[model samples]
Target: MRNIYLIISREYLERVRKKSFIIVTLLMPILMIAMMVAPSLMMLYSKSEQKQVVVIDRSGVVADNLYESAEATFIREDGMSKSEACNIYNEESGIFGILYIGEVVDARDSVQLITNSSSSMLLEESISSQIEAIVEREKLKEYNIENLDEILAKIETNIELATFVNNGATEDDGEMESTSTGVSYILGIVLGMLLYMIIILYGQMVLTSVVEEKASRVIDVMVTSCTPFQLMMGKIIGIAAVALTQIAIWALLVLSASKFVMPMLFTPDIASTSGALLDGALGTVTDTGYIATLFAYLALFILGGFLLYASLYAASGSAVDSIQDSQQYNTVIMLPIILSMIIMMTVFNDPNSPIAFWCSMIPFTSPIVMIARIPFGIPTWEIVTSLVILYLTFIAMTYLAAKIFRVGIFMHGKRTSWRELWLWLKE
Candidate 1:
């Protein structure tokens, strides 16, 4: 055990001392911030390039409203045909586009949009939506509805009901109110991505380290001082510590950036509504409270989940003598994480559904699913149970991996298989 600790320390220090590690540890946060800010900056720059669009409204019902709705100066071409409008729009190179609304826009009516300038999807969508709103309003007017408020009130319907539980207690209007679903989605995505990147990146690191040692014949020298099991444990523990260090740095950077850096990137007039991120907020799509809780759950889930998967990756590395040998087992290690992400995507839609519950309880998938559900305010006992199961699962997986690591590191000549793995387990 003492030998393992020494080996672990050596491995950790050796990797941590590398210049590349230092560079990446610091650069990742900046890269992440750049990725987040680029889209908003691009959008801000694009708004200044708006151009005038000509509207030829033969319908006349929605012309004025559509022009105001488009929020662009409209040159009224009320009597022009589609061809005439297109010709004029072509002559004006700087104009944004032309909107041709035919009489009624009925099944027989022709509606045409002509643009010589490069097409913008956002512009197209906005125009389409505006036209749709005007058409709907016109239809209402045709039905002798003089007032939109009256029409809206007549169409709107509401009903209320209460339910009785098995204990005869009334279930009132107790629907869970969410403050921000967008925040919850971001939380789930962040957790899923963090887990994914950590597992893949560090797991690859382990595999490469093992293969490098084996290829260079350095394991023989290391074996003289430490047993295969000790070497494996040392490598895993050391890498895990490094991962923890990196994660801590990332967490600190995120907290600091959110409080200090974000304001500089975005103006106060257009501050983004996207809120706190982490796994627990996945279900809190409509609630701000969920965003607050997400960070806490995310911290716990990420810590536990990273330790769990990193152990597996390290074990996989020890089991193989070369990168080619490791490739075969990589899918097995990655499957749980991939499946957990797929499960998380649907968790928000139905937090209490049977599929969500089962997946959340399963050890392999629970770390992610439970975190995703936490923002939605799951029962306290469920969270406790999931954590306990995940803890036990981690212990069991690491112990089994350590066993395989002991024998497989020294094995040579052929690739290991499931049968060999089981045999190692028994040994």
Candidate 2:
């Protein structure tokens, strides 16, 4: 017990004290948040010099509807031929484009944009769509309906859907559990991928640490005082603690940035730009407590997943003397994790599908798939059952892996095989 404690202490402190850890722990949150916000920020602040487009309107009806926008100014040139417009466009100094509307009003292909320089897609689409709308509105007038403009204006509508979950609502609003499957899908995918990354990273850390220790004969000195099970368990737990610590710190820093730093970063105009988008997002969230619950489960799953795999990683490490030799084992360990990601992708469409349900219930894939399902809402029994199965499987796997570890650490030099591992498990 004392030896295990000492090993755990050594493992945890050895990693946390590194310069790399400190720098990454501090910088990663800021980088991630910045990346998330950058595109929106660029769109909000980006500006283009107003383009001067000379409009030669052969179909005079269409030109009346075209208007000046932030990106462009349309100067109406009447009674001008296409060749005349092109000649003037070639002679002009500041004209960005010459837009020529053709004699045929109904042909969509007749309108041409003649530009010397490359044109923006936004400008081209805006012109094409506006002209199309004008033509459609004019064509509708041929039906001779009374007050057609007013009728069209009155009929245009956008629907806001308020989603309410009717199945097994246990929260404060027991009768109506409000939720958004879209929000659920986004949150689920993000959290699932996050868990996958953490498991791969920290699980590999355990395996590599074990391999290094064995290669240098440090495990030999350490095992004299500790049982193989104790040593393996200690490494797994200690590394998990380190991973949790790093994640916890990242969460704190990110939250702090969001709360205290974000306001300063988002100017009044910028804030207003994303205001309705944010409101729509927040409106979809029925219960604030549900998000809190996910984070809690996320912690549990991360621990369970890492511990479950760390045993195999440690055993694989024990069976080998070098990091390169661990490649054969990586494919086997990674298969379940990879499958969980594939299952997670499909959970976006149907979280409660038969395949998703079975995958989430299975202990091997549950850690990733279950997180993806929970955001869409799941039965309490299901999550509890999944966790129980996952941890129980972790215990069973650890026992089997320890058998390999106990035997493999001393068998150094030659490569280990699946048959040999099977024999060790039997012994």
TM-score of each: 0.76, 0.80
- Measured by lDDT, the strongest candidate is 2
Model 1 scores a TM of: 0.76
Off by over 4 Å in 1: 31-49, 69-71, 118-178, 261-299, 348-352, 371-380
Q: Write the per-residue lDDT of candidate 1 for residues 94-180, one digit (tens) a residue.
A: 677787887767545456667776767767776777778678877777778567767776886754232212333333654433234
Residue 344's C-alpha lDDT in candidate 1? 89
The lDDT for every candidate, in the order shown, is 0.69, 0.82
Clashing pairs in 2: none
* Weakest lDDT window of 10 consecutive positions for candidate 2: 279-288
**Cα-lDDT of candidate 2:** 0.82
- Local accuracy of candidate 2 as per-residue lDDT tens digits, 131-197: 8878988999999999999998999787656566676675575566545555566678668988998
| Residue-level error in angstroms, candidate 2, position 157 | 3.3
RMSD of 1: 6.4
